[model samples]
Target: MMNPESLRTVSVMRYILPLREGGSLPALAEADDDFKYVLKFRGAGHGVKALIAELLGGEIARFLGLPVPELVFATLDEAFGRTEADEEIQDLLQFSQGLNLGLHYLSGAITYDAAVNDCEATLASKIVWLDAFITNVDRTFRNTNLLVWHKELWLIDHGAAFYFHHSWNNWENSAKTPFALIKDHVLLAKASKLDEVHSEFTQKLNPDVLRKIVNLIPEEWLQWEDGSLKPDEIKEVYFQFLSTRLTNAELFLKQAQDARKTLI
Candidate 1:
């Protein structure tokens, strides 16, 4: 279980450079703690909702013993990024003032290459299960969103998970989805232990555990584009979506099992 107090908020000190790998244009930045971080701007494409998913997904993965970079609430000041040369980057920083999401930067980390690296069945299964539960659609071979640092696999860029929030309609029903996207998971071929990990992961993620992770979302990040729901209500929806999905894990587990069968 993640302690509510474990997530810290740090102020962004400097904009180091833009990581152009993804459309969101997340940047490498330095924080007040004097450590480098990969900063996800709230002003980016998906906006705060993406940040919300990052917090929920990353924390939930950590709760399940997955190796994720340390997550923090990074605040951007208005005066920062004034000297940037790029017009696109300058606009991104200008609109991205206020709270954002940051992942502790792992120096000398290389992207996970399934073709070259070997992953045990157990770890692969756990990762597939995590992506399935969150309805992540970005972990396909084309964009693995995984990093290997010091020979340890570290999960990153969870902003693409929990995609149901992109449209708030029928969120409860969304929880019942089988998340067919699991078919494209980079680790699907090696995830032979999905069933075993599903049972163990479900047990570890009780209602209390889910609530603690959901509660980590900052109120500022809860602004709905439709303006129909308040912050607390929005949080409740996320909690309900996750909890209901947990109760219906079989739906996605079956989908994953069937997908793996085709791959193997």
Candidate 2:
């Protein structure tokens, strides 16, 4: 059993995780003896690529008042070194006491049923579209991108974000997803479901929460190798997108308002 409390920082994560292997961000992490405080950092993000993408990307999703995991910036000093647990840190991270979105490890509960989880579909689609615009490629199905907690689906795992290449001006390849929100996606089916749960979900997220998330990104975390980027510029664009994304939210509200018309 290795003592994570004796470590000084994750420095970097290195392991051949066989869970989700495809696209760019291949899942890779090792487990430690630490009971529940596991830290995860993207491979490329460790050296470059504005690590803020993970923090603020979740913020953007939350700002839309959609179902997203509870995320925060967690630092593991060298005191928190590797444990002698299994082979992957993903499992350790799952049991982490950090800001989690109540994700429970279930063997057969996760599925692709549409009607049962339409709201998740809609939100996931919109996230895919928004991420596409920002060039994020971490919300696909392979990574167990979405998790169900207490019967509510929450989005997670956003390491791959803002990957725009001058050589190619199109979205990169991705895995199969139920709902596709490319461009101006209309989440009609899921929007209808949100009509009843808007108050419950929207109350957890707002503009202020979104702003707070941006403040959490460590300055050094945003440094890149090729050069530096104006994260501030991207932040502003995020706000603008927030303004428009709400329209998609309004569609969900329209669903709720319509439901009020019925007797049941």
Candidate 3:
């Protein structure tokens, strides 16, 4: 695993690319590599908590063994002196303009739907639920936040996570929020196949790794009316949700194993 601390040394340029309709990641080309990596610029004036959340979230996602892309934390340097009037508007694009490397935009040899749905049912379910439990704000149908690499689904774009801790701890009025309407969405229904797949793995989460992740967050990152949340709370909540998911997953798997029932 790449050390999370190394992200601070990534040399990012200031050239802004056009913002996609859905995500905050600025399009960026990795230095000297033919391939491009999506660059997410930290808001010019973000707090330590937000920064911590961004870094730790990526680290934890990888440690959890999810199909995430390799994350690199980079910075704006002199080669990045060029900027549009809105410095923050797509400021990460210049890094990708064939700097000896050709134009390599986001593309896959295959499409996301090509991944064998039945075979990856568990993987699909865990990632989606992890996002929901984390209250990740991206990954909607329009943005999906996934990439097809080696004919497998690889996750990308995490700048929108931890939105819950920042914006919704006391959000009792979930009905008023956009999330309330998704309870019975088709996506959720389809997720059942994944739920069944995931049930087997919930109890398998590496507790030691999870403990390290929760503790690694600089206490300031967790926010609530009273202040930041205790690390135990975060772990506990995650554990409970994942455990429930495991139970549900087992039932689904049992049904799938039985020839009479089809995988959802």
Best by TM-score: 1
Please provide, for model 1 over 1-264, each residue's C-alpha lDDT reduced to its tens digit, 9 standing for 90 to 100.
Answer: 444445898999988998886568999999999999999999899999889889888998888888999999999888877899988888888888999999999999999999988789999999999999999898888989999999989899898888988877899899999998899999999999988999899988888888888888888887666778999998899999999999999999999999889977
Best by lDDT: 1
Whichever of 1 and 3 has more lDDT, that candidate is 1
Local distance difference test scores for all models: 0.90, 0.40, 0.45
- Write the residue-wise lDDT of candidate 2 on 1-264 in tens digits: 111111123222334343443323333333332212212443322322334455555555665655654443343334232552553443343333222111112333364344445555455445444454344544433343565666877655455554442221322222112112222222333333343445444455455554555555544543334544565644544444443343245443443335333512
Kindly indicate the candidate among 1 and 3 with the higher TM-score. Answer: 1
Q: Identify the runs in model 2 with alpha carbons over 4 angstroms from their true place.
A: 1-39, 42-50, 79-144, 165-212, 228-264
- What value does the lDDT take at residue 135 in candidate 3? 45
Candidate 2 achieves a global lDDT of: 0.40
Q: Give the worst 10-residue stretch by lDDT in candidate 2.
A: 1-10
Q: What TM-score, over all chains together, does every model reach?
A: 0.97, 0.47, 0.56
Q: What TM-score would you give candidate 1 relative to the actual structure?
A: 0.97
The C-alpha RMSD in Å for every predicted model, in order, reads: 1.2, 10.2, 7.9
Residue-level lDDT tens digits of model 3 in 1-264: 332233323444333354354333444445433335555444323333344445555665666567666554444453454545655453433432211111124455333442243325456555655554444566655556666767676666555555544453543332123332223221343454544435444545445545555555433334434545465675455344334433344443333234212323
**What is residue 185's positional error in candidate 2, in angstroms?**
8.7
Candidate 3 Cα lDDT to native: 0.45
